[model samples]
Target: MAKRQVQTTKIDGKRVRIVTTTGANGTRVQVTEAEPKEWELQAAQVRALRGMPEYGKQFLLAGDQNSAKRGPRAQMEASAAGMTPGEADMRIYIAGGQLRMIENKVGRGRLSPAQVDRHAALARMGFTVDVLRAVTTEDAAHQAVALVRGWLAENDNQSGQGQPRCSSTACA
Candidate 1:
């Protein structure tokens, strides 16, 4: 006969354990660090972005913080992707079963045809994309949150219609 394995759900977001076997003395355990999978990271960044205080929010999409040459935005992106500082950046977020992205483009006049096609592809995979042009750190965070606020408001309005409310707090 084959032995069975025991699986355990983790309380923390970052770790999990699977018990492959047990002996007379002790149980064998395998621990896996739950680094945010790409999708989870994307979703968290989006939710963390909601209702952010106005001051630090700008760093979300552009690097304008401090006196550094690239600004907070450039710093954050470089750190997030493990890329060299000063390179351009983008981030995606998913919440309430919706997806959004923040793209820091230096210049723009509406999305290019290729960009639209790419956005459509993301949509097919269940994401709603938003792009923000971040010339600086202030640009990055502020624009990112602003986009989310608007999208969330729209989502709320759509959901509220014809829905029963438990209390006025639900409306708020």
Candidate 2:
């Protein structure tokens, strides 16, 4: 029989559990969190930024609702409805007629395997994808806002001629 061991550690000021079990073959470890505190904080910050009048354009939520607690039936329904795993948290339409995807992470959080695959796929399709991490800090948040503001400024300049420059092939 294998004995299970659990230990607590602080992640971004939140308590997380790391479990380990030793079996005849080897030892296995797992990490879990009581709640995604960091992610939630980052999401709130992102929403605040999105709500700003300067950046209040059309931004769509790409993540699934109640995804973590979804049952098999719900999963099936989502799949049928064309919901994909690892979709970016938000999709924004830039002024220059470009579509951008944003994925938010906080602290030392890294992208899941599915996210990595999806990012690669999107990149291959010529879409711009950006991962915004560590946004819980004011400095990081400000930097992100500045980056988006810069993009908006450039986009505004490009479309200053009354007719917006379309980046899509069908624009002609």
Q: Pick the candidate with the highest TM-score.
A: 2
Residue 167 error, candidate 2, Å: 14
Kindly list the per-residue Cα lDDT of model 1 for residues 1-172, writing each as its tens digit. 3354866566665446465766665666776643332223333434456446532222233221121356678868756865433221344332334434554453343555656666677778886555555433444556666666676566567666423334447334
Query: Could you report the Cα RMSD, in angstroms, for every candidate shown?
Result: 19.8, 7.2
The parts of candidate 1 lying over 4 Å away from their true place are 1-95, 107-117, 123-127, 161-172
lDDT per residue as tens, model 2, 1-172: 9989988898797778899999998999998874444446445647666766765352222333222457899888888988777777666666445676667666667888888888899999998667776634564456556656666677667667424456677446
Please name the candidate that would achieve the greatest lDDT relative to the true structure: 2
